[model samples]
Target: MNKQWFVVYCKSREESRAQLHLQNQGIHSFFPKIRKEKIIRGKRSTVEEALFPSYLFIFVDQEYTNFSKIRSTRGINDFVKFGREIARVSEETIKRLENACHSINDLKADTQSLFKSGDKVEIKSGSFKGLSAIFEAQDGLERSMLLLNILNQENKISFCNKEIKKAES
Candidate 1:
């Protein structure tokens, strides 16, 4: 019998743990992971997290490995199923997922940030260098909108992230 892919259900946030247990048992498994970036405490940090939370893929065949031990394995909830019908994933599907994740492993969460409205900021460069402004919002990954009161009217100006820095009060 050809080895078919099956989805393993793991406990909450236990995909890594279950993957390790299966590896020790000589089972072939794939736990797709991705790197995510988050802004915490006004500083940015990157974290490696499971692409499919609490789920991993395992290759199985009736003639090769005994699938019975999977359910009893620590950190494993069970094999994913639909009303007693076990789910089987095709090899092509798994391969596609592997390729997709590999391509984005080095990419960052460009649109995520810790900045919010009303935060004070200072333009570090360009025409408004060293000027203090109110942080309006992040326009995109590389741009932010700041509010500056010019001529007694609020003027919204967009600045690239590289051109601005958090101003200390």
Candidate 2:
């Protein structure tokens, strides 16, 4: 069979360990991570975390590495299985993920742009500086309806465009 990329499941929160194990064994693998700034204990810090937690991709070819060796690898639970079949991922999909990972690392995370409907935005100025709300639409590019939660219920309020910023999430 031709070499194919297949997703492998690892123990909870063990993606990095699993990737290290695969590397020591000389297996080809990819583990995508995203870098973001977070306020940790009142201090700003940058953390690189897995884009896909608890899952890693491995390239397996029957001509070289045996499937059993990969299955018995440390930190790896098993091949992601569907019924009795182990699904193979398309090369194009893997390439796209790799490119995205590269671009994300190269680009800074603080980019901002025009707000759209259903976009979660945080009030950056005015009386509600820290509140997050869902954007509805802009009226004449000045005011827009923001859906906010109060008393466990959604309350739509209109606020000017300059008072809001896109939520980090």
**Between which residue pairs do clashes occur in model 1?**
none
Model 1: which ten-residue window has the lowest total lDDT? 106-115
Candidate 1 runs further than 4 Å off = 108-169
Per-residue accuracy of model 2 over 1-169 as CA lDDT, tens digit each: 6788999988888888888889998888998898765767975566898899989999878577777888888888899999989878999999999999989776642223467789898998887889999988654334667899888999989886668788997
Residue 163 local lDDT, model 2: 80
lDDT by residue (tens digit), candidate 1, 43-122: 65567789899898999785776668888888998889999988989999999999989987844323235466888888
Per-residue lDDT value at 119 in model 1: 82
RMSD of 2: 10.4
TM-scores for every candidate against the unseen true structure: 0.63, 0.62
- Compared with the true structure, the alpha-carbon lDDT of candidate 2 equals 0.81
lDDT of 2 at 15: 84
Could you tell me which residue pairs clash in candidate 2? none
